[model samples]
Target: MTILCYHSVDPAWESPLAMRPGEFADHAAWLARHRTVVPLSEAVNRLDRRGRLPRGMAALTFDDGFAGVLEHALPEVQRHRLPTTIFLVAQTLTDEGLDAWWVRTPPPWPLATLTVEEVLHLRDLGVDLQSHSWAHQDLPELDEDRCERDLRQSREFLEDLLHGPVPFLAYPRGLHDDGVRRAARRAGYSHAFALPEGPERVDEYAVPRVGIHRGNNTRTLWVKSQPRYLDARHARRHVARTGRRLLKIG
Candidate 1:
């Protein structure tokens, strides 16, 4: 099974994380035709249970609770009738118009975040809301106690808001270490996700995701949707980053 990570979808925005509405629509249509899209929980459950995931199984996920998702991405998702999930920074739910760390202090353009009512509206639209962490801080950089606290607060707030269990997490900035993973386990998340460059050992707590960006077309999207693509990309990036670090040390 494959899980995809997306952040924003806007026509005017051209950042690495923002995808044009047309591109998103195309990707959604491609997935609709090529894959059996399922809910995030179902994919994770099958992975956890070691059950055989159906052929062409995939899931859609958005991170950071961006409002563009509701504006642009939602319609495509609805048109395709795909099940989706959004990982939210818990603190941002109550803080409308508050620019997240990425959008603050010299952001290229205003990046609007979703409010509580808006999130509830998405929930009404059948989108599962999960945690991206309390403050969207880098978990790997925090102490064990602080990391656990942040993760717990994120889950607690979302569970309260959603009136159900919030069992999944997508690490802030796709960054995590062993201690951070332990903190997530202690914080009670059944699984967590990172970008394609995640740790070598793939498990529930460090699932690799294929991040969809502005430049993705049908060809790139098809390549990314493969079941083996995630691990293979992870291996390549891990080696590349490790080499860079070794060179710096030398």
Candidate 2:
């Protein structure tokens, strides 16, 4: 099964990486026509039992509780009766505004984020809410103490708001080290999503996600769904980055 990750669904902003509402609608329509869209929990349960997913199964996930998700994405999701998981930063839901990481860009680009009320409303609409982090910091870069605080505190805040446990988490920037993974496990997360550039074995922790960014459309999405192509792409990127680092050092 392939899990597609999205950030925002707004088209007005020219970031092709963020799927526009129309593109999202089309993707949903395609999925409804061609794939079995399952909830993340059910997918994990199946993986735990049989070590394989049913044919044609796919899952949709959104990282960050962007306002555009509530405004644009949810409607399309609901229209298709699709199941989706959303990873949210608990602090972002508060009135204090988005973290610096999500807002490092110039004005208007970083201005879109969901309010607390909008997040609650999305919860009411059957969206599976989960934790991102407290301040959207890179978990692997932080010390153990900071990592633990961010992971546990974010989950605690979300659970308190929703009155239930939020079992899933996506690492900020899809970054994780051994300590980061350990921290997530300690925080009681059932599963964590990583932007690993391809599909991965659905373990109890560290499930891989195919991040959909600018320039991803039906063709690229289809290519990413295949394990062989995805693995090759990841290898290429690894080599490219290594070469760049070597050049810098030289």
Candidate 3:
């Protein structure tokens, strides 16, 4: 399934990962007009049942528990009745009050993050909640014990908070290795998501996603959402990577 990954949603924020509310709305409106936006689980079910996603079908996903998603993003998706999955950093979601947890590391603009209560409310509002990581650390850099601990702790915390199975995981920064994937499986995650490096593969534990960033317009979204877009994207990325290697050798 083609899942669109997003981060912060605020008109004022100035980051590639940040998209203004108006632009975000336009993208969703475009999807509602032209394509079918389904929940992550539904797409998976459809893929399993039919061996393919139906034409014009896609899913929405968010990484990091930013408050802007609550303030801006959710209203648009809710208006369209589109299902979305949010992968949250367990430590960033506070039970007390809103804080600067949205800033992964002192971003240029002020950021607000969703609280523990806000996330649960989102789940009640029909958004599926899953693990991003315990502290949003780079999983691949971590070794076996550390990686497994990070994955397991986050899964247990989210499942306990959401009161359901947290079966899916979105890797922090779309980074993972064989060790990380194996850790996720051992932690009880049935599926895992990676950042958009290229097309989505059949790997249940490392399915790639298309990142919908700040500069993307409706046309960009449409093109990226196409079934063969990732195939073409992967080819381009492969060529560039190979060229860089060859240049180094030369």
> Each model's TM-score?
0.90, 0.87, 0.89
Candidate 3 backbone collisions, by pair? none
Q: How does model 3 score by TM-score?
A: 0.89
| Residue-level lDDT tens digits of model 1 in 147-227 | 999999999989999998999999987788899999999999999988745335568888767788888998898888776
- Residue 227 in candidate 2, Cα distance off native in Å: 4.3
Give the C-alpha miss distance for residue 234 in model 2, angstroms.
3.5
lDDT of 3 by residue, 21-64 (tens): 88899998998888888988877665532123667888889888
Candidate numbers, best TM-score first, in rank order: 1, 3, 2
Question: Model 2: per-residue lDDT, tens digit, 1-250?
Answer: 5677888777676653467777777787887877888998887765533233456777888887777788888888999999988888888876675653653332364546777777788889888988988878878889987898889999999999888888888887777767888888888787787776323334556776777765576767667655445457657766676454321000
Question: Candidate 2's C-alpha lDDT?
Answer: 0.73
Error of 1 at 134 (Å): 0.6
Cα-lDDT of candidate 3: 0.78
TM-score of 1: 0.90
> Sorted by lDDT, highest first, which candidate order results?
1, 3, 2
Write the number of the candidate with greater lDDT, choosing between 1 and 3. Answer: 1
User: Which portions of model 1 show Cα errors greater than 4 Å?
Assistant: 48-54, 95-98, 103-107, 238-250
Worst 10 residues of 3 by lDDT: 241-250
